[model samples]
Target: MIWQGRSRRKPTGGLYRPHRKKRKYEMGRPQTETLIGERKIKLERVRGGNYKVKLVRDKYANVYVPSEGKVVRVEIKRVVENPAHVHYARRNVITKGAIIETEIGLARVTNRPSQEGLINAVLIEQK
Candidate 1:
């Protein structure tokens, strides 16, 4: 489990008195690493009686081309850039705001792949 609460120690390294117990809202979930591969999804039961679809591996992305005025499914070739992290881009880790190369062209990811179990991107104009 991940810790989402403030530390008991102060900035000066002095112990501080506890005011309250940990709450559900302060809970943290594990990091879901979505990778480029065959399509795969994992279901997670979240708080408030809701379920979330986590994409473990995705091969296709729904790319929206402005010129076409419609969305098209394209095979993901590789990750081009990831604003989240450079390492993630090199690792081909799919995440929100990641730029990926597809059969159609380069597209910027607009959705959270791990949380939505789907990759949605908007095509970028090539120079």
Candidate 2:
């Protein structure tokens, strides 16, 4: 069909286009991660983005990272690595964790494990 004054061609210009909304998920609201123990950490809201957590506590006091049986309250210790591994450093000396302390307690964690279905390390905290 032909028009009188205006053409039937779609406008190829400046008006803002509205977004389409869809209800696809079977469940309710989206799930989010819950941080236990320390809630001080604030990470980036966007997924896949990197976050760097720094110590805000007094410099005089130190953090304690457990080792073997005893805990090492080194002057300069922080969560240098994510989730499992942590790095502790003082002066120019740096030592990676053979064992580490988590929100629950101390445990020996690694990226990979040996043996089939066999995992190492458990919480060292007392009952």
Candidate 3:
């Protein structure tokens, strides 16, 4: 009876889940390399949950964490595509969380749409 209904089954094509164990550890690791001497931090994505990256090499993708408390210095690693996003040439940092207070502006985290190290998270300021 199980085999009969199997034919009508449909695929969701949501996440790419591998059947067997991964050759190496997947979670909490950056898919790509960061700048020569930058420290990458693990970021939390809304969907997948967590990912990792650096703060120097790709400032656009790294900094800009959810503002936990008052305004402070936050490094940016990835730049997103939205009104919150700024030009790569002129703009640099972003204020995560709290609806972006200062004119400092905001940038969206580069969802790993292209490169390897990319995750839905941003390498924001630690403080």
Candidate 4:
């Protein structure tokens, strides 16, 4: 688990003792890598007594084309670019703000595919 709290050191270089142990509220989960493949989802129990569906693998995306002024469900052809990381672009890991090539055209992802279980993209320039 990742630590979600601040360090015990002060900005002036003074050490501060812990007042309490690490709580579950200060824990974080690892990042999910949404890959290109058949749809796969994982149910995760989040805080506040709720559940979140994480997409492990997804093959489709809902692409919104401004030229047509409509949203279309299209199959993702491949990852075009990922400004988040060069490795992600090479490995075809779909994250938010990634540019993906769909059946309709090139689109920029607007949502976190791994956490949202669905890919939403807005059409950019055509290839």
lDDT of 1 by residue, 1-127 (tens): 4466667799999999988887877777887889999888999988887999999998999999998799999999999989888799889998899999999889999999899989999999765
Which regions of candidate 2 are displaced past 4 Å?
Answer: 1-97, 110-121
Every model's TM-score: 0.86, 0.19, 0.18, 0.91
Clashing pairs in 2: none
Q: How many backbone clashes does candidate 4 have?
A: 0
**For model 4, how does the per-residue alpha-carbon lDDT over 66-126 read when each residue is reduced to its tens digit?**
8779999999989989998889988999999999988877899999877878999999964
TM-score: model 2 vs. ground truth = 0.19
**lDDT for each of the candidates?**
0.91, 0.30, 0.36, 0.90
The predicted structure with the larger lDDT, 2 or 4, is 4
Candidate 1 colliding pairs, count = 0
Model 1 earns a TM-score of 0.86
In candidate 1, position 70 carries an lDDT of: 96
Question: Model 1 lDDT vs. the true structure?
Answer: 0.91
In angstroms, give how far residue 15 of model 2 lies from its true place. 80
